[model samples]
Target: MRTEFNWHLTAWKSLGRPSPGDIIWETELLNHSELVMRKRAYQNSTLYATFPRDPCDSYVHCGGNGNSVLNSSLICQCLKRFVPGSLENWNLKDFLKGCVRRKPFSCRNDGFAKYLQLKLLDTTHNWINKSKNLVECMAKCLSNCSCSAYTDIDVRGRGSSSAIWFE
Candidate 1:
């Protein structure tokens, strides 16, 4: 059988289980995020597979405002203008506490910082304005105090829409 596991922002490409003729399949949710699967053959042999090959592939792996630093020994880093939410946990290499803004935000004085080549966070709780361009998107987010981040709907396309995060 073929199966797929999906989340708000990402999904596993696909998983193909063994043919049913002589195999039995079982799946286990290893933790809050990881999933493991095993196939047992009638011959007393078993094959196993695990989802999310790395920490970066897990949902909210680095927590909010934390960027998963890929291709390095480092697992997470706070975004520009932000600091680790918990310095003690950060020192221990535990990023679950995520990040916090270095300075308090003031609606009129705060401005957005440009970030390039980032894999966006989960957008399940965001707002999408299809009619807004990049500039207009920035204005909208700026107008709303709750806005945290904004980006083009299609980063690699014509950018005809905007998606804004409010968390």
Candidate 2:
């Protein structure tokens, strides 16, 4: 069943639009179980809906860890929505490369604290829920000259949050 589903997903992905059968099957799958319905949330929130081309092959293999699937899907959706043009044209690999790049700096007062509020304004308006804690952490990072970038450590659960500092 998983292989068949994957084949259909890949075919639909290649076509750039869901076929009637795909739609029917998807609707049936979503209607059959709550878990499937929850999975559909990831599909509905996808930014690839607007794209007219196939995403990178990696897209199909998303949600490796059960805990991070939802967040991973959300991130993938954001990538598809914010970056203009087809996935083929977008330099997703490079974008992530830049994010992970480390620059020399001093973390004079660097330390990890729990429940630190941070805010990440989804410029693309992709992530529906605004994370105040994420926003504040981002603000803190921006205010500090030594901070390179901030990312969440825990993406699961309602109040999950964490940040990474580069020096």
Reference-based TM-score, model 2: 0.22
Clashing pairs in 1: none
TM-scores of all candidate predictions against the true structure: 0.71, 0.22
lDDT of 1: 0.74
lDDT string, candidate 1, 45-121, tens digits: 55456677878878677777888878867789889989999999988888898989999988788788889877776
Q: Please give the RMSD of candidate 1 to the true structure.
A: 6.7
Q: Could you list the CA RMSD of all candidates, in the order they appear?
A: 6.7, 15.3
**lDDT (10s digit) by residue, model 2, range 82-114:** 232234422352223112112223456543333
Clash count for candidate 1 is 0
Indicate the TM-score of model 1.
0.71
Q: What's the residue-level lDDT of 94 in candidate 2?
A: 24
